[model samples]
Target: MRLIVKIMLLFPVLLYSQSNFEKAEKLFSQEKYALAKPIFENVIKENPNHLKALEYLGDIEGMNKSWDSAMFYYGKLKQLNPKEANYYYKYGGCLGMKAKDCNKFKALGMISDIKSSFEKAIQLNPNHIEARWALIELYLQLPGIVGGSERKAQKYANELLKISPVDGYLAKGHIAEYFERYKDAEKNYTKAIAIGGSKTTYQKLADLYKNKMNQPQRAKLVLETYQDKTKS
Candidate 1:
């Protein structure tokens, strides 16, 4: 009888917390992050280990470019659930963004942590697509002395081929573009469009032609083709 009474006493509080979280989640889905953040804060206050609330708050901070704030939430999330791949990934991404605005030496110091976090995420989930993409970008952007390697980037890009063909081609195209290999980028982007043909794929190729290759006419033609394809 005492246990039943205790359960009854706790149920209302739990219900209120759940309802508050639900309301916050609805606001978050609508992208009213400012309004949602306070409710999520309240949810976390009531239940400190509320995973979704923490994740949502982290995401909101990330979107607002508040990297340190995002990192704090993601860091707590990883500690709370060490097995969750996405939490580590989010923490690494926030670290990467934070490094960008700080001094280069400080950024260099963070390299290992950032790399390890994303790598750990991949280790925990072999088929994680976003983690692989993050690693690919990291390799492409880092200097060779700091462990950057086009080969490594391509390796992940190849893995993406097996998991997602369009992403694979897009990543290859991105690497080529970064290196100023315009023709190679064009080929990869063309392949991506041939296979996927979405607006994003089309826009990528058009951007390459217009911005990098100085081929305005080609860019125009690509967009026209995209329009025709979509119309049909």
Candidate 2:
């Protein structure tokens, strides 16, 4: 009789937990994170295997920049669903964000995790542009074993370039710059500028010639052309 009474008492708590989970899902879809987090937490407390709740709560924590909490939730979710591509990717992104808080001081772990996550995402969906872009940027920024390698960076860049003319120019220019192939860089930069002129491309090329390559005269010529075009 006592056991039956205890079970009956627990029924409303279970119902309430499930109801809160549904409400949380609705709120989360509507971008009401502030309202959804507590309900998700309640659901997790009641039923720890709530995989979607755990994943979304971790994502919310990441979006809020609550790194430690995000890591905690993602870690839990990963244990439950280790093979899920999104779980790995989001976990890597959270680590990347946390690394940024330290201004690259803790970048090694972040880079490793990011690389792993991107690899997993690509395996899951070979055509995922976001993961491909992530890998491209990672290799481009630190092309060596310490972070990445020039050859690998060039490979990814070339792959991305094949998809579109403008992206090709951008990728080739980055690879050229990485290898100190200044002439190639200049040519690709020019092509990129001609196809789609952005102030950033102008600035990058100008700085490269002026500072890295010790060609201030060439940099000045570029600035002059830019001014002329802008005036026109």
Candidate 3:
């Protein structure tokens, strides 16, 4: 029958796609991006809307600091899946990174789009932590002549506190450190270490001691304490 012939012909193509995708996924997982990229490209060529393949390619480009390429893929993903928060987040992140190297006027022009993208991510998912963190940093760093506001930054920090206590303390500490309020930073970082005790918290406190406060001895002591704890 004609139907039987169509099924027979199509099965091989589907099988080939699946097998190739699996192999590409394995390479990607192993961090062999160069090897994986071409295969994923082929897969996307055959199936132009392949989500995972597109995401992998976007991630590879992001790792290589090819922001425009990453934005192209992520932009496609946003169009394909508009409600997906992470796609918007990645797109915004790519734009932010690209803006960093541009002329000040160009970077300023990019701010609205960057802010909207991250805001869209948060609007899509209210509990999105990374989007909130991005907003906090954006508000903190932008000059008041534009849109910067400590109040806006603190608002997100406060939201972070409600969602995650560790991040809350860390955010407050970051603001304090930015203002050269070393003792306040130490207080918040100390609380963060007590609650989380992760390497990130430890390193943050250590870096603060050494770089900001210029207390190398205290930094050394903190790192030494962390190493001893890890060994035990």
TM-score of 1: 0.96
lDDT for every model? Answer: 0.95, 0.78, 0.92
For residues 150-225, write the lDDT of model 1, one tens digit per residue.
9999999999899889999999999999999999999999999999999999999999999999999999999999
The positional error of residue 35 in candidate 2, measured at the CA in angstroms, is: 1.1
- The C-alpha TM-scores of every prediction are 0.96, 0.61, 0.94
Query: Model 1's lDDT to the true fold?
Result: 0.95
Q: Whose lDDT is greatest here?
A: 1
- Candidate 2: give its CA RMSD in angstroms: 7.1
Pairs in steric clash, model 3 = none
The 10-residue segment with the lowest total lDDT in model 2: 125-134
Model 1: per-residue Cα lDDT at residue 150 = 98
Clashes of each: 0, 4, 0
Worst 10-residue lDDT window, candidate 1: 122-131
Query: On residues 61-167, what C-alpha lDDT tens digit does candidate 2 reach at each position?
Result: 98899988998888887789777777766777777677667755477656777788778876776545556566666777763666676667666666666655555
Candidate 3 Cα errors over 4 Å, as ranges: none
User: What is model 1's C-alpha RMSD?
Assistant: 1.1
Best by TM-score: 1
Model 1 alpha-carbon drift over 4 Å, by segment: none
